[model samples]
Target: MMKILLIVFNWVGKGTYWRALKFAEHLCRRGREVTLLATSQHNRIGIEERIINQVRLVETPDLFTGSLRSGWDMWNVCNRIAWLRNHDFDIVHVFEARPVALFPALYMQRIKHISLVMDWADWFGKGGSVEERPNPIIRNILRPVETFFEEHFRTWADGTTVICTTLQQKATELGVPPNTIVMLPNGCDTERFEVIPHQIARRRLHFPHDMLIIGYMGSIFQHDAELMACAFDIICQQIADVRLLVIGYCPIDIRQLVKKPQYVIQTGFIEDEYLNNHLASCDVCWLPFKNTNANKGRWPLKLNDYMAVGRPTIATAVGDVVSLFETEPIGLLAEDNPMSFAEKSMQLLHDSTLRLEMGTHARHVAETRFSWADLTRRLEDLYQYILKTGTK
Candidate 1:
């Protein structure tokens, strides 16, 4: 049996961690021995090690978590390299391309001849929109490292998995063979995110029974809250009983920006059990991404979750969202502005039949195309191919 090691740079809370776990679980079920190693920010916390759903998960303290002073990063990289030597892995699947992520895999390649697979989920250079760029000092320091990772990592990697076509294009431009790259888009855990009756869900969450709820769930990054506020205001003027459900943390206070603060409900980052209930309780879901280079490459996990719960989404045509909503009528797409977004959302809110139809289509798409079960099979096939054909 092939032994695979999945390496993540962060804790179990993030998107990468979930993706790694799903892959490991599926791979283990297929008779491959899979182990996932993740790092946490907490200091002096006991090592988090467990066998969850047949996948082995081991967590350790993040080497450079507290301080970024001189030599700490290198020390962490060396420690990680040393730790990696203890395991006998046929493949090292890295989720990021940072120095810490790369050095250990490079060491394993040289010493143990284990193959390496790198997954690129974002553009990772210059960071977000032009306005969102880091300060000059930070920019100057990060520019070279980001550039090196973007340009040369694929050339050295044995195999690559990309989240979107933009990253695939970037990989091809960097001279990575198309055959070596697998298009592993983000997916939903359909079993967990399945539909619950809206009335029951709303009752459990203490939301109004008659109101039309518009939900925006998950972490809010590069999402224009001001624009969403304006859109919701327009939605309110058109519809009599409209409510906005904002779940998770946002940089901007969406409640303060919107006109009807009373109509908005903020359920600050709840547990996963409550997430599906919140998603199913909504009449419509919103994905308001600012149309920027950084957003263009992202595949929002919330979009998949929304679809999995059988709710129609009104999303800005950014990133993989354009391809997702454009090809199929599962959801409505609009420009990344207040007026355009508001118009599409109002159309969905007013038309109950249309919303139901779109919701059905969205669920079908989620089950057929974006289920983790299907996606993991693809991942397993890719791993098999990589193992069969020696490292490139």
Candidate 2:
């Protein structure tokens, strides 16, 4: 039987943590013994363990819950590494390259003689997401540290998984073996969400049946949020019955930026059970991203949320999203401007038949291409390659 250890730098909240859990759960059902190591959400000083859907979840305490990155707890890594020495795993998959994430993963590779695969799901250094930081001084300080962690450790991996072609190109440019680098976007958890009728969902959520709902899911970075706010303002100028459904946690109150605060409905972070209900309430979903390195380097988890509920998206033409639009008529892509975005949105709003068609296509692609079952095959294939050939 294959044994796999999955290590995440943070608690079970962010996109990366969810990705690790989903992959671990999928692997466990396939008869692979999988263990997931993550930081506990609370600042407790104790470690905890449990079995969730047949996968062992080990959460180590992290103190810095207030920091932007969070989970700078090297204590857990040290203690876990010391304890992990007694266990044997065929593969160790590390998500991201932070102090807490990298240290234990490197220990598994170097000290325990286990095969290591590093996953790069975001571009966080220098010209990427660092540009999104509000403070210039903080950005300048983090440039070197972020680069060192994000770029310096790729060669240590036996294999690598990237979320987009842009990051895959960056990894290969950094001299990671091209064959070892697989472009694996975050898979849609189709099993978790069922397609609900848009009107029925709106009624369930107590939203007005007359309003044309445009939903945006999850927290967004600052740059994208500004662009989204601008686009929404423009959208209101043309449509009267429109409303913005801001589902989950957003850094800023979207109502503050828009022309009409009354039209914006902000449902702060709700549970997983109500996720589909919230998402399905939208007539159209928003994916307003500017054409930048930051947007290109990462796949938005909200895109998966939009797909799960079978809602057509009004996205700006950028990076891998453009590749997605080309492959399937899942949604319409607009230029990175308010006028263009508002225009494409108007086009979708007016045509109900086209919107429904695109929504069905979005749902189909999510089920077939981006489902966890299908994506797990690619991951397992990479594992098979490493196991058969011996780790690099």
Candidate 3:
């Protein structure tokens, strides 16, 4: 049996968390032994260990509690290294290039002679996510640091898995071989994610049945939120009965951004138990991403979330989203401007038959094309090849 170690920088709740956890679960069923290492709390010094659905999850302590990003805690890195010393695995796949994940994975490869593979989910370097920082000081400080960490170590890994074509291109430009790189986008929860009845979902939440609802999954960046606010403002003028449904912890202040705060329903931070109901309540979902490097280099996880709930999306035609929209009639794509986005939203709102047809197609696409089974199989193939030739 092949024993694999999967390392992610943070614990549960984020997109990266789900990615690593799902891969671990799927790979386990494929007859591979998988252990996931992550950072749970900042205050604790010792490790907290548990088994989640046959996969072992070992949580290390992160020293810095105040910082929003994980993997900066040196104490966490040392703990991970110490923990890894006792266990032996055929392959170690580190999810991100942060200090906590990258340094320890590198140690196991260099010192222990274990095969190492790195997964690049986001572009976090010189021309990538560093530019997404709103503060100029933060951007300037992270520019070289992010570049050094994201670029300097990727080439040395045995193999690389990227989430999008944008990052695949970036990895190749950074000197990684084409053969060693695998591009796997986000997948849907076809088996586990339940689709609740739309009317019942709205009634359970006490949302009015008469109003036309437009949902935007939360956790947006400042600039993306700016584009969303602009599009939403234009939407409100033409359609007076429209409501904006926000389903999670949004950094953007919807109340202050719009003309009608009453129409905005923010659900704050919600647990996974109520996720399906909240998603099913919306008539249409929106992905108001601007045409920027940050938006272009990354694939939005919420797009799949919307698809899972059988909701048609009004997404901006940016990044790899262009291909997904052009290939499938799952949803309509809007231009970068607010006027175009509002127009697309109105187009869907006026026609319920079109929305239903597009939404059903979206769900079909999710179940067949972007399922986790196919993704894990491809990843398993990569693991087999890496173990055979070491991607040299």
Candidate 4:
């Protein structure tokens, strides 16, 4: 069995962390010995305990607050390198391409090391030269540091894996060899999101059975609030039975839009169980992304989650979403305008046969292409290739 060491900054409540966990779990189940090194700042001890095989947690002290900033983040790379010099491992996989981690990964490669680089930052426009909205002095001060980490990490990694083709192109533009980059898209835990009876789920949530519910799940990022509010306002005006179910945290200004009881149902920052329950009850899942530079490379995780539960998705044609869904016979891709979103959503709501058919097709696509099991297999193949050839 090959021994693998996986290095990441921290494991908090994020999509990247979940993907890393699933990847580790899958590799371990395949009889590969794996060790995960993560920061202890986020109280991830519980997360460590859930894994099936050998694992270790290195608790580094938080330097700034002695509570949040893991001072050892920079030292973590050197320490891991020093430890690895004495230890033996077949491969080192770095999830986030930060300088602190890259220095160690590069060092490992210099000794003829084998590894896989999972790049998420490049896709989100973090390394690009695109102009961002002007921010306060603090943000400006920290911007350079963020850029340095992103740029260095991309240049140093041996074999790079990106979430979307847009990101892979960005990596090539940034000097990474075209052949070194591979697409390892985000995937959903389909079995966890198996279709449940819609009316039963609605009744469990105490949602009105008569109302036509449209839902949005996951974190509300930049400009999401304004776009969702504008779309919902237009949707409510046209369809009397239409109700919006928002399952995550919303900004204060956006939450105020739900004041009118007839239009909105805001379940502020729901737990995973409740969020899944509400999703199972939804008539349509909304993914309203703003047409910003950062959004251009996005492959929303919610898209797969929505599809897994057999819910019809209505989203903006931002990033690679059009390519992913337009080919599928399941969902609708609307323009980024409120009127367009409202019109498309209403059309889906009015046609029950179409909704059911689309939902079934969406679930089929997710099961065949987007399941975590299938995704892990792709990662495993990448890992095996790195081990055999030491480079892509």
For each candidate in the order shown, give its overall lDDT on alpha carbons: 0.79, 0.87, 0.87, 0.69
Rank by lDDT (best first)? 2, 3, 1, 4
lDDT of 2 by residue, 28-50 (tens): 88899999988877745777888
Q: Pull out the clashing pairs in model 3.
A: none
Evaluation by TM-score, superior candidate among 1 and 2: 2
Query: Global CA lDDT of candidate 3, please?
Result: 0.87
lDDT of 3 by residue, 1-392 (tens): 99999998875556587888888999999999999988885545899889997899898887677335467778889999999889899999999889988988998899998899999988888878789888999899989998888889989999999998999998999899999999988888876665666799989888888889999886887777878888888889999899999988887788788778888888888988777888889899999988887788787888888888888999999999999999999999999888999999999999999999998988998888888888899999999999999655
Candidate 4 runs further than 4 Å off? 41-87, 99-116, 121-134, 250-253, 257-262
- In the order shown, what is each candidate's alpha-carbon RMSD? 2.7, 1.3, 1.2, 3.6
Backbone N/Cα/C clashes per model = 0, 0, 0, 0
How does residue 25 of candidate 3 score in lDDT? 91
TM-score of 3: 0.97
Better of 3 and 4 by lDDT: 3
lDDT of 1: 0.79
Residue 202 in model 4: lDDT? 88
**lDDT value, residue 376 of candidate 2:** 84
- Put down candidate 1 lDDT per residue, 45-163, tens digits, no spaces: 44567888888787655545533321125555655676777778988898867665667767877788888898887676655332344377776777666767656767888899998
TM-score of each: 0.92, 0.97, 0.97, 0.85
